[model samples]
Target chain A: QKEVEQDPGPLSVPEGAIVSLNCTYSNSAFQYFMWYRQYSRKGPELLMYTYSSGNKEDGRFTAQVDKSSKYISLFIRDSQPSDSATYLCAMTQRRAGTASKLTFGTGTRLQVTL
Target chain B: NAGVTQTPKFRVLKTGQSMTLLCAQDMNHEYMYWYRQDPGMGLRLIHYSVGEGTTAKGEVPDGYNVSRLKKQNFLLGLESAAPSQTSVYFCASSYLAGGPFGRGTGELFFGEGSRLTVL
Candidate 1:
């Protein structure tokens, strides 16, 4: 099985709706969780980040990590057309004085319509 | 400054052909990475460089090679391109201020991806 699993969602939602994207991983060693948004023809952009389990809020985006279940989520409030993009979930372990490489999930495509 | 830049934004190759993709970073970061995004397969690490003159194979390093001769540059090479190698390639760099920050730690500062198609 893949270490990380996310639904390849082409989820369509009306503008202003709340959107939730999630991923599940089998590796318990993953301590750093992240969410990225990728527009067409561009590289993925970081949206949210969290360490260990719990919730983090930034603007309209919230990231939640549940280490016990190996699950993580990104919540988008008041979604807009600008929020339409491919959402990717990533995880990695902490490495001192070096860059912690990331493992990403198959992105979920989101489309917010007015 | 351009955070990260990749050359030849797009390319198409026939099977058995060879090519190299170049990635340059201006963030003065100590780490650089190459990842391939495939449909439903997600992003798989092909190779990475911790610092100049150091290279490491990642999860999917087969059929690919890499070099990090300069602090700001990393190159990924395909000795013989195959249909399976067709994908969007991305290069990323992370600042050293944080403890080994990955893409999640902050904006990874990715270059516009290189789209490759091998027939």
Candidate 2:
């Protein structure tokens, strides 16, 4: 089984709609959770970061992590056309003084229509 | 700021031909990583470096080699390319992991990406 699993969604939603993207992981050791946004022909950029089991809010985006369930989610409110992109969930166990090995999900594609 | 820059934005290679992808960072980060993205496969780490003169294999390291000769540069080389190796390559850098909360949350800065086609 893949370490992280996400729905490969081409989910189309209208502007001003709320969009929720999620991922599930089997590794209990994963301590850091992240959401990344990738545009066409571009590398993924870090969108949100949270290490705790609650919610973290940044602007219009909210990231939720449920450690017990091994699930993480990113919620976008009042979505805009500019939010159209692939969203990927990534996680890694925190290790001091070393490189953290990150495992990424297949990503969920989202489109916001006008 | 040019956080991370990858060279040869696009290229096509004949099977068995070899080439190297270069990643340079101006952030002076202590960590660097190389990942490849494919349709429905997401991004898989190829190799990574914790500091200059140090290199380590990642989840997908076969048919690839890496070098971190300089603190600001990382190189991923395909000794002999294959069709399966054709993918968009990304290079990223971050501060050392496990810092105090809210700082350097392992947030990675990435380059645009290098698209390689093996025909």
Tens-digit lDDT track for model 2 on A46-112?
Answer: 8998976999999999999999999999999999999999999999886667686789999999999
Question: TM-scores across all candidates?
Answer: 0.95, 0.97
Which segments of model 1 are wrong by more than 4 Å?
B97-107
- What fraction of the reference structure's interface contacts does model 1 contain? 0.72
The regions of model 2 sitting more than 4 angstroms off are: B98-104
Give lDDT: candidate 1, residue B118. Answer: 98
Q: In candidate 1, what are the lDDT values of residues B20-94, reduced to their tens digit?
A: 999999878888999999898998888988899999989899999999999999999999999999899999977
Please give the lDDT score for candidate 2.
0.92
**lDDT by residue (tens digit), candidate 1, A1-114:** 999999998999999999999999999988889898999999988888888999999999999999998999999999999999999999987665656588899999999999
> What lDDT tens digits, residue by residue, belong to model 2 across residues B9-108?
9999999999999999998888999999998888999999999999999989999999999999999999999999989999999887654444646778
The C-alpha lDDT values of all candidates are: 0.89, 0.92
